[model samples]
Target: MIVIINYGSGNLKSIKNGFTKIGEETVISQDIREMEKADALVLPGVGAFGTAMEHLESYKDIIHEHINNGKPFLGVCLGLQVLFTKSQENKGVKGLDIFKGEVMKIPEEGLKIPHMGWNNLKIVNECSILDGIENDYMYFVHSYYAKPDDEDIIAATTNYGIDLTAAVCRDNVFATQFHPEKSGEVGLNILKNFVKSIPSK
Candidate 1:
Protein backbone atom coordinates (compact mmCIF):
# COMPACT_ATOMS: atom_id res chain seq x y z
CA MET A 1 0.00 0.00 0.00
CA ILE A 2 1.03 3.61 -0.55
CA VAL A 3 1.59 5.39 2.74
CA ILE A 4 1.16 9.18 2.86
CA ILE A 5 3.21 10.71 5.63
CA ASN A 6 1.06 12.83 7.99
CA TYR A 7 3.08 15.32 9.97
CA GLY A 8 0.33 17.76 10.94
CA SER A 9 0.32 19.27 7.48
CA GLY A 10 -2.69 20.31 5.49
CA ASN A 11 -3.76 18.76 2.15
CA LEU A 12 -3.74 15.15 3.31
CA LYS A 13 -7.43 14.63 2.52
CA SER A 14 -7.11 15.92 -1.01
CA ILE A 15 -4.10 13.65 -1.62
CA LYS A 16 -6.00 10.63 -0.28
CA ASN A 17 -9.00 11.48 -2.45
CA GLY A 18 -6.84 11.79 -5.53
CA PHE A 19 -5.37 8.33 -5.00
CA THR A 20 -8.82 6.91 -4.26
CA LYS A 21 -10.17 8.37 -7.50
CA ILE A 22 -7.42 6.49 -9.31
CA GLY A 23 -8.42 3.26 -7.51
CA GLU A 24 -5.11 3.03 -5.65
CA GLU A 25 -4.86 1.70 -2.12
CA THR A 26 -3.41 4.39 0.15
CA VAL A 27 -3.15 5.16 3.85
CA ILE A 28 -2.31 8.37 5.70
CA SER A 29 -0.38 7.81 8.88
CA GLN A 30 2.20 9.29 11.24
CA ASP A 31 3.02 5.93 12.78
CA ILE A 32 6.63 4.95 12.24
CA ARG A 33 5.85 1.24 12.11
CA GLU A 34 3.15 1.74 9.50
CA MET A 35 5.54 3.85 7.42
CA GLU A 36 8.23 1.21 7.67
CA LYS A 37 5.93 -1.48 6.29
CA ALA A 38 4.59 0.66 3.41
CA ASP A 39 5.20 -0.54 -0.12
CA ALA A 40 5.91 3.04 -1.08
CA LEU A 41 5.95 6.35 0.75
CA VAL A 42 4.37 9.69 -0.21
CA LEU A 43 5.52 12.64 1.86
CA PRO A 44 2.85 15.35 1.52
CA GLY A 45 3.05 18.70 3.25
CA VAL A 46 1.87 22.31 3.16
CA GLY A 47 3.37 24.45 5.90
CA ALA A 48 6.46 26.23 7.16
CA PHE A 49 9.83 24.54 6.69
CA GLY A 50 11.06 24.49 10.30
CA THR A 51 7.86 23.11 11.74
CA ALA A 52 7.64 20.40 9.13
CA MET A 53 11.25 19.44 9.72
CA GLU A 54 10.60 19.05 13.43
CA HIS A 55 7.78 16.59 12.80
CA LEU A 56 9.87 14.61 10.32
CA GLU A 57 12.84 14.41 12.62
CA SER A 58 10.71 12.45 15.09
CA TYR A 59 10.60 9.62 12.59
CA LYS A 60 13.93 10.13 10.86
CA ASP A 61 14.99 6.57 11.35
CA ILE A 62 11.95 5.18 9.60
CA ILE A 63 12.36 7.55 6.66
CA HIS A 64 16.08 6.95 6.34
CA GLU A 65 15.63 3.20 6.52
CA HIS A 66 12.99 3.21 3.80
CA ILE A 67 15.01 5.30 1.38
CA ASN A 68 18.11 3.28 2.11
CA ASN A 69 16.21 0.15 1.16
CA GLY A 70 15.58 1.58 -2.33
CA LYS A 71 11.82 1.80 -1.83
CA PRO A 72 9.78 4.04 -4.11
CA PHE A 73 9.24 7.40 -2.38
CA LEU A 74 7.63 10.66 -3.43
CA GLY A 75 7.56 14.08 -1.77
CA VAL A 76 5.17 16.93 -2.58
CA CYS A 77 5.67 20.73 -2.17
CA LEU A 78 7.26 21.40 1.20
CA GLY A 79 7.67 17.66 1.29
CA LEU A 80 10.00 18.05 -1.66
CA GLN A 81 11.95 20.81 -0.01
CA VAL A 82 12.73 18.90 3.18
CA LEU A 83 14.50 16.08 1.32
CA PHE A 84 17.40 18.34 0.48
CA THR A 85 20.35 19.30 2.70
CA LYS A 86 18.89 22.64 3.83
CA SER A 87 16.29 25.34 3.15
CA GLN A 88 16.60 29.11 3.29
CA GLU A 89 12.88 29.59 4.06
CA ASN A 90 13.30 28.61 7.72
CA LYS A 91 16.33 30.84 8.31
CA GLY A 92 18.54 28.12 6.82
CA VAL A 93 17.13 25.08 8.59
CA LYS A 94 18.78 21.73 7.89
CA GLY A 95 16.84 19.17 5.87
CA LEU A 96 16.92 15.36 5.84
CA ASP A 97 20.09 15.46 3.67
CA ILE A 98 18.92 12.55 1.56
CA PHE A 99 20.23 14.48 -1.43
CA LYS A 100 22.99 17.01 -1.68
CA GLY A 101 21.15 20.26 -2.23
CA GLU A 102 19.56 23.33 -0.71
CA VAL A 103 16.13 24.92 -1.01
CA MET A 104 15.85 28.56 -1.91
CA LYS A 105 13.02 31.04 -2.47
CA ILE A 106 11.71 31.30 -6.00
CA PRO A 107 13.00 34.45 -7.63
CA GLU A 108 10.20 37.05 -7.38
CA GLU A 109 10.27 38.79 -10.69
CA GLY A 110 7.13 40.63 -11.82
CA LEU A 111 5.21 37.53 -10.74
CA LYS A 112 3.75 36.92 -7.25
CA ILE A 113 5.68 35.60 -4.23
CA PRO A 114 3.82 32.35 -3.80
CA HIS A 115 3.46 30.91 -7.29
CA MET A 116 -0.19 29.87 -7.04
CA GLY A 117 -1.43 28.69 -10.41
CA TRP A 118 -1.05 26.18 -13.23
CA ASN A 119 2.35 26.08 -14.92
CA ASN A 120 3.74 24.00 -17.76
CA LEU A 121 6.59 21.66 -16.91
CA LYS A 122 9.66 21.22 -19.08
CA ILE A 123 10.46 17.52 -18.76
CA VAL A 124 14.20 16.91 -18.68
CA ASN A 125 15.00 13.40 -17.49
CA GLU A 126 12.30 11.00 -18.67
CA CYS A 127 11.10 8.68 -15.92
CA SER A 128 8.27 6.26 -15.14
CA ILE A 129 6.41 8.75 -12.89
CA LEU A 130 5.94 11.05 -15.86
CA ASP A 131 5.06 8.20 -18.25
CA GLY A 132 2.34 8.92 -20.86
CA ILE A 133 2.25 12.57 -19.85
CA GLU A 134 3.72 15.16 -22.14
CA ASN A 135 4.69 18.67 -21.12
CA ASP A 136 1.46 19.50 -19.28
CA TYR A 137 0.31 22.01 -16.68
CA MET A 138 0.61 21.17 -12.98
CA TYR A 139 -0.65 22.99 -9.89
CA PHE A 140 1.94 24.65 -7.66
CA VAL A 141 1.80 26.76 -4.49
CA HIS A 142 5.12 27.41 -2.91
CA SER A 143 7.67 30.15 -2.25
CA TYR A 144 10.73 27.93 -2.23
CA TYR A 145 12.32 25.40 -4.64
CA ALA A 146 15.09 22.85 -4.44
CA LYS A 147 18.46 23.27 -6.14
CA PRO A 148 20.17 19.91 -6.27
CA ASP A 149 23.92 19.73 -6.67
CA ASP A 150 23.42 17.02 -9.28
CA GLU A 151 21.50 18.35 -12.26
CA ASP A 152 20.99 14.78 -13.47
CA ILE A 153 18.42 14.17 -10.76
CA ILE A 154 16.07 16.83 -12.17
CA ALA A 155 13.23 15.11 -13.98
CA ALA A 156 11.40 18.27 -15.01
CA THR A 157 11.72 22.03 -14.82
CA THR A 158 9.43 25.09 -15.05
CA ASN A 159 10.26 28.62 -16.07
CA TYR A 160 9.44 31.52 -13.77
CA GLY A 161 12.15 34.16 -13.42
CA ILE A 162 14.61 31.37 -14.13
CA ASP A 163 14.33 27.65 -14.90
CA LEU A 164 13.37 25.95 -11.61
CA THR A 165 13.44 22.26 -10.87
CA ALA A 166 9.80 21.12 -10.97
CA ALA A 167 10.35 17.42 -10.44
CA VAL A 168 13.33 15.39 -9.29
CA CYS A 169 14.16 11.70 -8.85
CA ARG A 170 17.29 9.94 -7.63
CA ASP A 171 17.04 6.17 -7.67
CA ASN A 172 13.97 5.15 -5.63
CA VAL A 173 13.39 8.72 -4.37
CA PHE A 174 11.11 11.05 -6.36
CA ALA A 175 9.62 14.47 -5.66
CA THR A 176 7.50 17.20 -7.22
CA GLN A 177 7.34 20.83 -6.22
CA PHE A 178 3.87 20.98 -7.79
CA HIS A 179 0.88 19.23 -6.28
CA PRO A 180 -0.08 16.47 -8.72
CA GLU A 181 -3.17 15.78 -6.63
CA LYS A 182 -4.53 19.25 -7.45
CA SER A 183 -3.35 19.38 -11.06
CA GLY A 184 -6.60 17.84 -12.38
CA GLU A 185 -6.49 14.94 -14.86
CA VAL A 186 -2.83 15.31 -15.77
CA GLY A 187 -1.97 15.51 -12.09
CA LEU A 188 -4.00 12.41 -11.28
CA ASN A 189 -2.21 10.60 -14.06
CA ILE A 190 1.13 11.48 -12.49
CA LEU A 191 0.01 9.99 -9.18
CA LYS A 192 -1.29 6.94 -11.01
CA ASN A 193 2.09 6.56 -12.61
CA PHE A 194 3.72 6.62 -9.22
CA VAL A 195 1.27 4.02 -7.88
CA LYS A 196 1.94 1.73 -10.80
CA SER A 197 5.70 2.22 -10.44
CA ILE A 198 5.69 1.08 -6.82
CA PRO A 199 7.44 -2.24 -6.27
CA SER A 200 5.21 -5.15 -5.20
CA LYS A 201 5.06 -5.83 -1.48
Candidate 2:
Protein backbone atom coordinates (compact mmCIF):
# COMPACT_ATOMS: atom_id res chain seq x y z
CA MET A 1 0.00 0.00 0.00
CA ILE A 2 1.17 3.54 -0.73
CA VAL A 3 1.12 5.70 2.40
CA ILE A 4 0.83 9.45 1.85
CA ILE A 5 2.08 11.49 4.80
CA ASN A 6 -0.69 13.75 6.10
CA TYR A 7 0.79 16.60 8.08
CA GLY A 8 -2.07 18.97 7.36
CA SER A 9 -0.22 20.76 4.55
CA GLY A 10 -0.91 18.85 1.35
CA ASN A 11 -3.61 18.53 -1.35
CA LEU A 12 -4.49 15.23 0.28
CA LYS A 13 -7.81 14.47 -1.41
CA SER A 14 -6.64 15.25 -4.94
CA ILE A 15 -3.51 13.16 -4.53
CA LYS A 16 -5.41 10.28 -3.00
CA ASN A 17 -8.04 10.49 -5.73
CA GLY A 18 -5.40 10.51 -8.43
CA PHE A 19 -3.99 7.26 -7.13
CA THR A 20 -7.45 5.80 -6.83
CA LYS A 21 -8.25 6.73 -10.43
CA ILE A 22 -5.19 4.75 -11.44
CA GLY A 23 -6.46 1.79 -9.40
CA GLU A 24 -3.71 2.12 -6.82
CA GLU A 25 -4.53 1.77 -3.14
CA THR A 26 -3.37 4.72 -1.06
CA VAL A 27 -3.79 5.79 2.54
CA ILE A 28 -3.33 9.28 3.96
CA SER A 29 -2.11 9.35 7.53
CA GLN A 30 0.13 11.14 9.99
CA ASP A 31 0.43 8.10 12.26
CA ILE A 32 4.02 6.92 12.53
CA ARG A 33 3.21 3.25 12.88
CA GLU A 34 1.06 3.20 9.74
CA MET A 35 3.86 4.91 7.85
CA GLU A 36 6.35 2.31 9.06
CA LYS A 37 4.22 -0.46 7.59
CA ALA A 38 3.73 1.19 4.22
CA ASP A 39 5.22 -0.38 1.12
CA ALA A 40 6.14 3.05 -0.18
CA LEU A 41 5.58 6.62 1.01
CA VAL A 42 4.36 9.76 -0.73
CA LEU A 43 5.00 13.12 0.90
CA PRO A 44 2.54 15.66 -0.54
CA GLY A 45 2.31 19.26 0.57
CA VAL A 46 1.03 22.71 -0.38
CA GLY A 47 1.81 25.48 2.11
CA ALA A 48 4.56 27.60 3.68
CA PHE A 49 7.98 26.03 4.25
CA GLY A 50 8.30 26.69 8.01
CA THR A 51 4.79 25.50 8.83
CA ALA A 52 5.29 22.33 6.79
CA MET A 53 8.57 21.59 8.59
CA GLU A 54 6.91 22.11 11.95
CA HIS A 55 4.33 19.43 11.13
CA LEU A 56 7.02 17.13 9.73
CA GLU A 57 9.04 17.47 12.95
CA SER A 58 6.18 15.93 14.85
CA TYR A 59 6.85 12.74 12.87
CA LYS A 60 10.53 13.17 12.13
CA ASP A 61 11.36 9.81 13.60
CA ILE A 62 8.94 8.08 11.24
CA ILE A 63 10.29 10.03 8.29
CA HIS A 64 13.91 9.26 9.13
CA GLU A 65 13.15 5.66 9.98
CA HIS A 66 11.47 5.02 6.63
CA ILE A 67 14.36 6.48 4.67
CA ASN A 68 16.78 4.45 6.75
CA ASN A 69 14.83 1.33 5.79
CA GLY A 70 15.39 2.09 2.08
CA LYS A 71 11.70 2.24 1.14
CA PRO A 72 10.74 3.93 -2.10
CA PHE A 73 9.58 7.46 -1.32
CA LEU A 74 8.16 10.38 -3.33
CA GLY A 75 7.71 14.02 -2.30
CA VAL A 76 5.70 16.69 -4.16
CA CYS A 77 5.81 20.52 -4.16
CA LEU A 78 6.59 21.86 -0.67
CA GLY A 79 6.95 18.22 0.17
CA LEU A 80 9.97 18.22 -2.13
CA GLN A 81 11.36 21.45 -0.71
CA VAL A 82 11.44 20.22 2.88
CA LEU A 83 13.73 17.30 1.92
CA PHE A 84 16.51 19.80 1.39
CA THR A 85 18.86 21.20 4.06
CA LYS A 86 17.18 24.61 4.25
CA SER A 87 14.80 27.04 2.54
CA GLN A 88 14.81 30.81 2.11
CA GLU A 89 11.01 31.00 2.28
CA ASN A 90 11.30 30.45 6.00
CA LYS A 91 14.35 32.39 7.11
CA GLY A 92 16.66 30.27 9.36
CA VAL A 93 14.29 27.29 9.17
CA LYS A 94 16.02 23.97 8.58
CA GLY A 95 14.56 21.26 6.33
CA LEU A 96 14.50 17.51 6.93
CA ASP A 97 18.17 17.54 5.85
CA ILE A 98 17.70 14.26 3.96
CA PHE A 99 19.55 15.69 0.99
CA LYS A 100 22.31 18.25 0.93
CA GLY A 101 20.64 21.26 -0.64
CA GLU A 102 18.72 24.48 -0.10
CA VAL A 103 15.48 25.94 -1.45
CA MET A 104 15.35 29.49 -2.73
CA LYS A 105 12.76 31.81 -4.23
CA ILE A 106 12.61 32.07 -7.99
CA PRO A 107 14.19 35.30 -9.13
CA GLU A 108 11.64 37.90 -10.10
CA GLU A 109 12.38 39.18 -13.60
CA GLY A 110 9.25 39.87 -15.64
CA LEU A 111 7.84 36.48 -14.60
CA LYS A 112 5.43 36.05 -11.69
CA ILE A 113 6.35 35.27 -8.07
CA PRO A 114 4.40 32.05 -7.82
CA HIS A 115 4.84 30.18 -11.13
CA MET A 116 1.24 29.06 -11.38
CA GLY A 117 0.73 27.34 -14.73
CA TRP A 118 1.88 24.58 -17.05
CA ASN A 119 5.61 24.23 -17.73
CA ASN A 120 7.71 21.71 -19.61
CA LEU A 121 10.30 19.63 -17.73
CA LYS A 122 13.75 19.05 -19.14
CA ILE A 123 14.79 15.55 -18.18
CA VAL A 124 18.39 15.40 -16.95
CA ASN A 125 18.97 11.88 -15.60
CA GLU A 126 16.30 9.35 -16.51
CA CYS A 127 14.57 7.47 -13.65
CA SER A 128 11.63 5.11 -13.06
CA ILE A 129 9.30 7.89 -11.88
CA LEU A 130 9.55 9.44 -15.32
CA ASP A 131 9.33 6.16 -17.18
CA GLY A 132 7.36 6.24 -20.47
CA ILE A 133 7.09 10.01 -20.16
CA GLU A 134 9.41 12.16 -22.18
CA ASN A 135 10.21 15.79 -21.48
CA ASP A 136 6.59 16.82 -21.04
CA TYR A 137 4.68 19.65 -19.42
CA MET A 138 3.55 19.43 -15.78
CA TYR A 139 1.63 21.76 -13.49
CA PHE A 140 3.46 23.90 -10.94
CA VAL A 141 2.53 26.41 -8.23
CA HIS A 142 5.46 27.43 -6.09
CA SER A 143 7.72 30.37 -5.39
CA TYR A 144 10.76 28.32 -4.35
CA TYR A 145 12.84 25.48 -5.81
CA ALA A 146 15.55 23.12 -4.58
CA LYS A 147 19.25 23.36 -5.46
CA PRO A 148 20.92 20.09 -4.59
CA ASP A 149 24.61 19.87 -3.66
CA ASP A 150 24.97 16.75 -5.83
CA GLU A 151 23.92 17.28 -9.45
CA ASP A 152 23.34 13.56 -9.93
CA ILE A 153 20.03 13.60 -8.02
CA ILE A 154 18.41 16.00 -10.49
CA ALA A 155 16.23 13.90 -12.78
CA ALA A 156 14.71 16.85 -14.59
CA THR A 157 14.69 20.64 -14.82
CA THR A 158 12.49 23.52 -16.04
CA ASN A 159 13.19 27.04 -17.17
CA TYR A 160 11.60 30.30 -16.06
CA GLY A 161 14.38 32.78 -16.94
CA ILE A 162 16.53 30.63 -14.61
CA ASP A 163 16.84 26.86 -14.61
CA LEU A 164 15.02 25.07 -11.76
CA THR A 165 15.24 21.57 -10.42
CA ALA A 166 11.86 20.05 -11.34
CA ALA A 167 12.49 16.56 -10.03
CA VAL A 168 15.15 14.90 -7.89
CA CYS A 169 16.05 11.39 -6.75
CA ARG A 170 18.89 9.93 -4.70
CA ASP A 171 18.71 6.15 -4.29
CA ASN A 172 15.16 5.29 -3.18
CA VAL A 173 14.29 8.86 -2.26
CA PHE A 174 12.45 10.94 -4.86
CA ALA A 175 10.75 14.34 -5.08
CA THR A 176 9.12 16.65 -7.62
CA GLN A 177 8.52 20.38 -7.46
CA PHE A 178 5.46 20.03 -9.74
CA HIS A 179 2.11 18.57 -8.74
CA PRO A 180 1.77 15.40 -10.82
CA GLU A 181 -1.73 15.00 -9.46
CA LYS A 182 -2.84 18.09 -11.34
CA SER A 183 -0.65 17.70 -14.42
CA GLY A 184 -3.16 15.72 -16.45
CA GLU A 185 -2.58 12.32 -18.11
CA VAL A 186 1.20 12.64 -18.19
CA GLY A 187 1.23 13.42 -14.51
CA LEU A 188 -0.99 10.47 -13.68
CA ASN A 189 1.43 8.28 -15.59
CA ILE A 190 4.21 9.51 -13.30
CA LEU A 191 2.19 8.47 -10.27
CA LYS A 192 1.50 5.10 -11.91
CA ASN A 193 5.21 4.65 -12.49
CA PHE A 194 5.84 5.32 -8.80
CA VAL A 195 3.19 2.79 -7.79
CA LYS A 196 4.80 0.15 -9.99
CA SER A 197 8.15 0.83 -8.33
CA ILE A 198 7.02 -0.46 -4.96
CA PRO A 199 9.54 -3.13 -3.95
CA SER A 200 8.13 -6.61 -3.68
CA LYS A 201 9.89 -8.93 -1.26
RMSD of each: 1.1, 1.1
Model 2: per-residue Cα lDDT at residue 41:
90
Residues 32-64, candidate 1: write the lDDT tens digits.
Answer: 889989999999999988999998888778888
lDDT on C-alpha atoms for all candidate structures:
0.89, 0.91
Which pairs, if any, clash in model 2? none
The lDDT of model 1 is: 0.89
- The top-ranked prediction according to TM-score is 2
**In model 1, which regions exceed 4 Å deviation?**
none
Q: Which parts of model 2 are misplaced by more than 4 Å?
A: none
Residue-wise lDDT of candidate 2 within 1-201, one digit each (tens)? 789999998669999999999998899987888998999999999999999989888777888888889898999999899999999999899899999988989999998889889999999998889988777999999999999999899999999989899999887888999999999999999998888778772
Candidate 2 structure, TM-score to reference: 0.97
